[model samples]
Target: MLYLFGAIALFVIFDSVRGYLKTEDKRKYLVRLFLELTVVIGLLFLFGPLFVLSPLKIGYSTLKEGNITLYYPGGSIDMARDVMEQLKQAAEMNRQFYKANYPMPVVLAQSEFDMLRFGSYPYGGGTGSELSLNIRAGQMTTGKIAHEMSHRNLAMLTGKSMPAPNWFNEGLASYIGKMDEYKKPNELQVDLREGRYVRDILEMRGILGTPKWILKIRQGKGRVLYGQTYLMVKYLFDKYGQEKVYDFVVSLKTNDFEKAFWQSFGMSEEEFFQEFTSYIQNYRGEPS
Candidate 1:
């Protein structure tokens, strides 16, 4: 905010001096500058610190693909193109993995400020075929986009034919996004190694509705939730591969993820959850 004000002040002074020196009527362009400055400042405040409204007011270019469209600012053409390529690659990968071509997600990124408009947004998130994504203006990373696309592809792949219980949405996304790919030890493992871990999936597995519990938002507990679910999904995916787990998601359309669990992994939820916790307890860092 200080920088913004300082910039405005500098512009105002420069414009004032330019009008005085270059124009017969110094007050004329000075007045115009003041009006323009007012509008710009109003927009800046109205749009928050992110300048989201600047591009919105100015309008942005759109890039269209088979099933995706990227809305981006003119200055971000190169960055936007890069993201487009990545999305296309992701779509192709999803096609091979799902055995079906679904409506790919719409990718939109202009600035982090534009992304901040999303309520409670953390980097980016996707639902079905719509994606709200964020990038660092001229930069792109694989964290949030990968995770959200994990949710999107599965949702679209199943379409209306299969309605997953949605318990493992984030976990499933993290699994497909390959959070482990970065080779960063998860918070769960770090805490466990430090002997500070206390939450027990084994005890809570059957008592709490897995879907309800997983879906619930408890501030500051996202790591625990994501860690446990990611490990569980990783186990399932590694054991049965992507196709089998997708079949299990399809089976969940009947709202019987319990039955799907058995069919997919041949184990009850409680047993599986307990086994997963036990595995983490005995196994070394990171899941193989």
Candidate 2:
């Protein structure tokens, strides 16, 4: 839709310029050009930041360190430096943990409003190679940086077209980022006991990392989904070890995720899910 709108706007501008060059009526051409320009500006407002020209809407200072490049607005250079350092640490941690490296472009939004204007929220978002973070939202942490970088790293390693399951992606990222620690054990216990936790395997596998899922987090229902998946990945890590997990992620480059899982873990994903949920249910102690 953005592309189509852009093409139409360009055509309108081109045609208007041609008409102005040839036509004898300068007054009429000026009127038409004003209307056409208005339409183009209106289209930009309608499309918001998803339009290709969205990045140009803000003035960003660039900072580079290794494979990471930071873009931050004015008056936030200190925060940008902090973000760059954290991002560097996160990338190194991911490489050590997952044995994967990917170039990342990080955007530090000075406020929630800036974040929203950039097509993200206060928390932050990872769209494959790029990450947007709201540094002023009091949500910035090393774990959060690691979490988004994990997503980008996996996307690079696995290939975006056939990426792993959303639940796995989010869970592993949460585990790596330590975002799971935000949810208290007692709180998770209440969720599990009150039947508010993820139950169906299909539900777990289909859990998305989109904005709607973020809305669920805002509504207080997302903790279970995120918490459960984090525990799931943590469970595998505790039982199998990071080497097996790394192998599984690396195998995703060639094999389907389920196939890679079975080859790496000696159990089907369904079997693992059953075992994990049962472990959660039968354990006589605090979960995780």
Candidate 3:
């Protein structure tokens, strides 16, 4: 549409110039040229930014580091480097943990709305086929980006999405991403002892597949739930080791979830929960 407008505007200007040459009418030619320029510039100003940016273009600039490519708006050059290195290190860590060599695109959005505009929210994540992270402005954290990157690693390692409770996915992302970095260990102990940080997986199940649940989680439930899920995943991963963790994730889409987990961990959800309940009650701080 802009191109069509531009072409027509150009024609008007040229015709006006031709008329000026033929008749020497200076004001007529000037008015026509001015109007044409004004309309053309208006069209360019109105739609130029949108046409040049994603979903049409990824960003205003690009930077490459290892297997990661960063797309972000103009800002501090040094900050972009720092952000890239931070996420690259994170992607590398997830790769090492899961034995994944997959690549990912990291998009550092200028704002929450910018993140959404590029199809990257609620915060960050990547699907199997494409490893990527879309982070909102000022939300940079190793755990946050790592959590999303881990999902891509999982998909790359398995070559497909896994079928499992959303909890397991969140747990895996949280655990490997090192969510404990933001946690106040002593405060966690206090929360647990005060019955404020209880891990109520049963209650969590009731909220799934609902819009209200998404809103709640996005608003605040994620903080508590991620902490709870992180601890549970850490316990399981530590017990079974890395390869087994990979086995467990891939198996989710291949077999009965219960059966797959049982085969991988040698326990059912009932038994696992019983043990987890006991462990959390006495939890003090980070494990040595």
The deviation in Å at residue 177 for candidate 2 is: 1.4
lDDT, candidate 3, 176-264, per-residue tens: 77777534445555667776564555344322422333565676765556666676778787787878887787675567567888898
Residue 152 local lDDT, model 2: 73
What TM-scores do the predictions have?
Answer: 0.60, 0.72, 0.66
Candidate 3 regions with alpha-carbon error over 4 angstroms: 1-59, 74-77, 122-131, 182-213, 282-288
**Candidate with best lDDT:** 2
Q: Which ten residues in a row have the lowest lDDT in candidate 1?
A: 124-133
Report the lDDT tens digits of candidate 1 across residue range 11-67: 878867876799887678779777987886676544533333244534457777887
Local lDDT at 103 for model 3: 72
Whole-model lDDT values for every prediction: 0.57, 0.68, 0.63
Clashes of each: 0, 0, 0
Model 3, C-alpha of 174: deviation from truth (Å): 2.2
lDDT of 2 at 218: 78
Instruction: For candidate 2, write residues 167-203 as lDDT tens digits.
Output: 6887888888878764544565566788886665334
> Which model, 2 or 3, shows the larger lDDT?
2
Candidate 1, superposed: residue stretches over 4 Å from native: 1-58, 105-107, 111-113, 118-140, 160-167, 181-190, 193-225, 284-288
Rank list by TM-score = 2, 3, 1
